[model samples]
Target: MAKLLGLDKVATFFRIIRGNGGIFGSVKTLFRTDELKIGNLIGEDKYGNRYYENNAYFVGRNRWVIYADKVGLNYDGSQVPAEWFGWLHYKTDLPPNKDPSRPKYKWMLDHEQNMSGTNQAYMPYSTTRPKIESWQPPQ
Candidate 1:
């Protein structure tokens, strides 16, 4: 059914039905599943995101991205680390695997999920602020 809809195999019939198989309409369905053609196994990063390409994009179509099998909790965009960022957006001509110029540093930070607005959010400290504000009755 995905073939008929011109969508990736991971995409469901419901999404294709609802989105009508257009790029703009597919935004809502983005990250919902794997939607790329894998003519070749590119490379994997420490966080386990996989990259693939079909080379069919010559006509400006048929590029794809497949999240690792371990990424089950949910994709929040921040799941994608900086290393794979280049391959994901076609920024580099080589995949991380084939790229000889890729760099590694001792101070490199691990991938961190975006936790803003969530319960595990970051807390800032301020020495001048009072712990509790005085409650005042409105006049």
Candidate 2:
């Protein structure tokens, strides 16, 4: 019972710090209560994303992902691999590891996290010269 109580308190702390549960979540628990409670770890993808579920919470809201990289909390939705995405959304009952129907076609591409705001972000190359020339006071 004491351990349970301690866990509850911890959960409340995270809720308050993260502001996950909203005003009531913050004021009441001071931590995301849901986050603190232990949940069944569903699976982890190749990219280090972890999926978890707790039946105590509502079905849709119970499932969540703990991102592998902090990335300043700027993580994008695309970071979730295709297989894990299905599990998170309730589209499939089985996780990628257990799914029998999952395909392994040669053409299928590997998963890659989004790099939108980083130095690795996509940059297209063009051969055309600049339309607007730089100004020159005097040569």
Candidate 3:
């Protein structure tokens, strides 16, 4: 119960100091009021992302992935790779490890988490000069 309150950790002291003990942590914390998902952890990937499946399927779907990082700072759809995305969204019945048909082509590049809004974003070269110029100061 103390853990649910975010009061049990020494790290919480630092977070409290950082913010005078206002609301901290995240949406996942609400669901993790108990350790409901911890025991159901079926697999972890190289990046420390964990995968789970609840046996109780409302229709026919029972798969989910929890990232190591919380949703706010690290949240982005691009963090999920193509292969794992397939399994997460029910496009494939097999996990990446167990799937034999997954390829190992030499020409293929490793997947990178997206960098669209960051400094690593793709920039195309322009062949044409800019039509509009800044007004030159009188000199």
Give the number of the best model, judged by lDDT.
2
Cα lDDT of model 1 by residue, 18-125, tens digit: 543466445433545634132455666677765556574563343445555566646566777876776667687677777778888889877798898889999898
lDDT of 3 by residue, 19-131 (tens): 32233443344343322222245567776677777665543446766666654445566777788888888788788878888888999987788888889999999999989
Candidate 3: which stretches are off by over 4 Å?
A: 1-28, 31-39, 57-61, 70-72, 132-139
Which candidate model has the greater TM-score, 1 or 3?
3
- Worst 10 contiguous positions by lDDT, candidate 1: 29-38
Instruction: Say which prediction, candidate 1 or candidate 2, comes out ahead on TM-score.
Output: 2
Better of 1 and 2 by lDDT: 2
Pairing residues by index, what is the TM-score of model 3? 0.60
User: How well does candidate 2 score on lDDT at residue 56?
Assistant: 75
Ranking by lDDT: 2, 3, 1
Q: Score every model by TM-score.
A: 0.58, 0.63, 0.60
> Model 2, 62: alpha-carbon shift in Å?
1.2
